[model samples]
Target: MSEQVFLLPDLGEGLTEAEIVEWRVAVGDTVTVDQSVVEVETAKAVVDVPCPYAGRVVALHGAAGEVRPVGQPLITVAPLDAASSPAGGEPAGHAVYREEERAGSGNVLIGYGTGHGGAGRRRRRPRLAGVDDSTRTAPLPAPTGAGATSAATDPPAVAPSSPGPAALSSPGPAAPARAGDGAALVISPIVRRLAREHGVDLATLAGTGPGGVIRRADVEAALGTAPAPDTARGLSAVPDPSPDNGTALPGAQPQDPTGGDVIVPLTGIRKAIADKLSRSRREIPEVTIWVDVDATGLLETRAAINAARPDQPVGLLALLARICLSGLRRFPQLNARVDTEGQRIVQSAGVHLGIAAQTDRGLVVPVLRDAQRLTTTELAAELAATTAAARAGTLAPARLTGGTFTLNNYGVFGVDGSTPIINHPEAALLGVGRIVDKPWVVDGQLAVRKVTQLSLTFDHRVCDGGVAGGFLRHVADCVEQPALLIATV
Candidate 1:
């Protein structure tokens, strides 16, 4: 088999590098074309890197927790038919291997990713068995929650070289042991990441998901933070006692050399956030404007809608999103971004609304593509689904970028107000504060009402205070009277 080197393809969005999270196949292990061989954590998301060549793995280029640049050698494979040829040597069985490569993978990376579409068939292409038995498996089991699903659809692709043993020698009730045996029933890489951060052992903890799949909740429960209905027994309430294991956050520097402080290496999501925020601050001359709004009508409208369709109740954020959409329609200046290189203000034809969600990894803003086309209900559903994906750490890299406008609901953390840094390139951000009971004048009379503080941080380069105030006032008007949305519709 001719040895083919697989370089880490450019994981889009102009990303230049990624941190190696784990490797599914070790040296000597066989892999099929499109089979995920590694999981890499980029600035935006955790993604599975598929093998383009179907062959026996001869070399792994990097270890977990290391950063690899784009176009660098990731893995090396000896094509199944090229047994006599070694790397850098003339191919003995080159014709057979090259033919298979051309037919199977088209001589390169498969569209930069096979993550969401998923790899075709994980089953090995049989040679010893002397048959092509690799067939697509049955459907994935029912989803328990956002990150909780079967291994078929979104396999976590746990690495064989876990810090601890893969599984217990003695099995428990949830599923079979995995050490030196089979793969772990983990569907989300975030769950695997969470376990590593908290030093939770997947082999020991019984999963509560479909067919005993370990979900993020299982790891959280094991960490003594998130509650679980049927968490595994015989698990430690705290992180394990490994010297440099999950107990510490990922990317944390090993014990301080000078005993001064534990320095956390800013790499994955944290680095992305820092760079974006710094660029936004340095480039944009920004301004913050806030207003108090009576949200009684918005709350009532939501209640009436929920009463009408309890099965698909609209969320407050969705309603706010609807309001933002309307406000932007009236004052489209807020729905824009600044092009420094081009020296112009670019207004988007459609609103790609970004919703900020805080997960175990950090803050992530998942964008809704062409949100102008979605109704409030559709907006709610999209928000819910993307929020789940964000929480699961499975959000596509595409979903994390290209936002024309941002809606930050920091009220979930009970904050009254914040002048949030604008998502870089995006001209504006609308922050919604906690809804609380406050006294307000209704028809010149004092009354207690559901009131919320709204904060708008926008680029001075995009619009002046007049345009910013007009947008915020329009949103407040919609909050005070949901019927205003009719005109928008």
Candidate 2:
């Protein structure tokens, strides 16, 4: 039979490689055009790699947890009619393979060209035994806390892979383990790592997931009550082992040094973040400056807005974002970036504001396109939606890049101030600290006022302190006197 090998396609955002989280199609299983045959986790997102040819899978290239580079063969499929010869008298394998390629639906992964709509399916084509069309194209499960009814579906297309049978339906309790087989039906690396940390034997517990698969929640359940923050940080109560003379003391922690400490490899999004941050620090000469502002006026304005329109209350962050936009307009230098290779400070004409958001996956900055043009109400809505998408691990790669300037509200973390590292390629970042009641002199009288600190970190090469200070002062002025926003608002 003619075998056609499919290479891993670029999943966008210039990602060069992906880890094989799970194989959707096993050897000998027939797959149709545009049907998802493998699930891969790129640096940016976990995506399903669709099969371009309608054929039976003859070979699988990589195992779960193995990273594969772009342009490498992912799977090899033999067209169903490979044995039949064409009327042109070409080799049967070659002729059949050519026909299969011609019949391909030309559908690719997300953000790439896909012939099918969001349906992720095409018209019915020939199939083989052990292939169920319904389960192969099921939508990924919703993010936790979405309030959507949890349906038994494939784990997720944008999360760390969770492997199982093709169907999401439960197969009842798993049968008793056979000899020499002790690993449970667990797919998540986090779950496995956590279980190992807690010394929980997977072979001994009954999983609560579909088909008795072990889940993160199930492992936590077996550890009795949920783990407290500190305990959750590590399996044991011992703190991080202190180093002595630049060396780790033997037997000072949970794992013995003789056995070697865990060496977690940096991959996927974590690696990408590391590379960018390291480059920023190595290349950019940065300086930080901060100022404390009396935020009583901003608080009052926000409260009044909420009272006027409780249905669409504006968030404090949205107000601060508006202030940043105005500050950028006055001192555009802070909104520019140093194009080192190009040897120029490329100042963007419009503000592509980025909001630093923490998510289950990692820290991500989702950019709001043309943020300067949006009203406060529109800004609030976009902020809410972008932050939600970030937390849900569903923000598109495009939304996570191309930010000219960043607004970081570390206030949510209840911190007072931070000299945050600049997001790479961006010249500056504005950080807002928590607002709290503090004694302040107002109208020549001491009284409790809502006070917040604002810090700015900028690339020294992009602009001087005078420019940075002016931009920050403008923002602080807007915070202290909300009326200052009138001209720009």
Candidate 3:
């Protein structure tokens, strides 16, 4: 059998593993070259993985929710004319399968090649042994309409020869499949964890997702969290309270005297946040400095700008972001990354501002590319659109990364000040606290004014406190006297 195997391709941005989100094609189904066979979520974004070979699907390597590292067998497909190919067949390894992943983007992955053909080009993917073939059922042929399975119907499932849920590893250090724990058809690890925490039996609940895979809402519904998800307070709240960039999610507790212990395993974005933050703390010698500023001028300028363009009113974040760009222009040292291993400081040529936003998935810093070149209105529009995309989970992997500096507005959460950790490798992070009415000395008299606290966390390796303090003072001056930014124009 000229069976070919496709591996989970590299997700780039140095990500090593991706959790299988869904299996689009099953065993015995036919797939064309570049056809999306599975959906996988990396630390960066959720992406549909396309198969590189065209043929009959002989096997699927892992079930949804399983995290597979780069270069593992994803699917095995027989030759286009291999009509006699057997279903649920063992992967034929390098003798047949090549692990090239054509993930939509024609751009070839790091270690993977674009298989243009020829048997000599076949690359071998690591195969897992002792795969639970119980889930490997041959697809039942549809009875009518060109033998097609309609969209409303259940996706092709393996015949009774299998009660499914493919395993990631036989007994490796990988997370054990929930099926082994007597769970069924649950594709989301978060849902599984929620069920386990609430003592809810998965077997008794009906799933509402594609192919009967359990969803987070289904589990939440079982737990009576029904108050319209949009209004519910849990993971969806914005203005992340955690000390900037990467930190633990809010509402996490090590111990609860009344509830024994509620432990949420770090997964998905949470895991990414933890990894990035841990790296930042371990390698970077960081320092923090904060200043309280009279933001009345900045806010008044925003109001006047909005009054002129009522249809496109600017936000406080937008004003603060513009001021940040100005400050970075004056002190380019803060807009940089540390090449610790190379023992070098790398300042960015252009400002790719990372906006820290709290999304339903978690806190993601979506970068505004070439931010230094944008007008205040363009910057505001881009920031708003990028943040919306992040929350809506439509942002591409590239948009979520490659930030030179970060702007975190913890003020959205109504906090006064925070000592935020810098995003990993990045030299500095600028945070803004809430703008509130407070007593201020204006014209040498104590008067009520809009005040806000600005905090900056910078890598000591990048610049001394003198530079950091100067950059921060510049930002404060811009806030106190909005005309300072106009002077540059």
Candidate 4:
């Protein structure tokens, strides 16, 4: 049988090496063309590399967590037809192997390919059309009052009945009530932990989050202005309100603080993020520029649009995306990347905007392909899909890569401004801050207006300060006068 060697391909974004995360096929296992052979974690993302050859796996080069360079032999496959060669064809076999080696030399494994050369170009996928744009305006879950008694008093009909000793003691629906319905809150894990440590009841807090889902802000609001408990004065002791049913057993003793502590190993998404961010900081040189924008016009336009289409959930980010896309056309330099190997700048014809989403695992940037071509409603639908997939950890490898630019909204976190790190390989990244009422001079008169801060971080190697400033100004112009976006488009 003839043996064929499989080499690792460059996975693009200038990644030189990857750590093998898992091997789907073992020695003696059969693999087909385009079938995943192994999963590799790169500095940017986790991707499954498909076997280019169809044959039985003869050997694996290395185990998981071993970093291997690009274009190196990763595995060997013995083709089924190798035994049929004539005795005298040994010389011819060597020649064929050499030819195959040469052919695979320049081929990249996945998203990285020389088809576009040093340009780093990709074909834009068409946006999924005809989706309801109205859903973009869907209200986020609002904060609800914490505590069972508070919720029971507010919505008596929906509250669950107090289970008896037999029901409460059982490990079923009773667990939720015993936990004070805190589990029902849609807040993040960190928020939940904070609430528990501070003895805050999620049910008693009024939710300001979308869809009446209680958020961290709601919990803080509920605990507002309360005097700090003095632990030394014995004012810090709080009673546990868990139901005391006859069938329920006593709780376990608290562990010693000085005893052995838990050591949680970073794996999955967290590990992936650390590797990527470290690589980006080491490889890419980032420069940032901040601009203050008057968002009064944008706010008014959004309100009017929402009023006209009450069913759609239009968000501030969606509007900002539209403005950014419009600005990218005038300043296409911001829509490109610098190719250090070629010593030239490569411009992308299409706009794929990546939005940074914080999930339970880590930060994920899912691309909204062809953001420039999509309508406001279409963009909103795509953004929702990307974010939902990210939070669910179902985003495909392709969706996580090939971003022309990125947008990070720190406003949701209540931060007014921040200098965001640029997603490597992309020319620029935009950071949007919280909107607030601020005094501004409009037409020479001072007035209180809704305002926000926009910060742009770019690769100085490709774009100069002048170009970056121009791009920021362009985006600010569109956001301040959103009507101009429709007119220009």
How many clashes show up per model?
5, 0, 4, 33
lDDT of 3 by residue, 1-489 (tens): 567878888778788887765565668655555555666777776665657776777888876566788888888988755433335332222123233322212223345545566434433221111223354435422232211211113222212122222332232322322433443455333454345434455655665653345565666676653222221112231223322222223332223334444444466677899999998999989999999999899878988998999887677777888888899989999999988678788999999999888764577888999998988888778877777556545577878788999999887666899998888879999988888999999999999999989999999998999999999999999899988887764
Q: Rank the candidates by TM-score, best first.
A: 1, 2, 3, 4
Provide the overall lDDT of each model, using Cα atoms, as 2-decimal numbers.
Answer: 0.68, 0.65, 0.65, 0.59
Where does candidate 2 have its weakest 10-residue lDDT segment? 243-252
* Residues 89-183, model 4: lDDT tens digits: 22112111111011111223564223432212211100000112221212212222222222222222111211112211222211122223333
Reference-based TM-score of each model: 0.74, 0.69, 0.67, 0.52
- The residue-by-residue lDDT of candidate 2 on 1-489, one tens digit each, is 478898888777787898775555567556656656666666665565677776767787877667889889888988776454346433222211111111111223543325555452342221111112332333322322211211112212122222223332233333432212443555334454455545555555565654355566676676764333233223252122111001111211233224545443476677777998999999989999999999999988988998999888688888988999999999888888888788899999999999887644567788999998999988888888777656445556677799999988877666899999999899999998878899999889999999999999999998888999999999999999999899866
Instruction: Provide the lowest-lDDT 10-residue window in model 3.
Output: 146-155
Candidates 1 and 3 compared by TM-score, better number: 1
Better of 2 and 4 by TM-score: 2
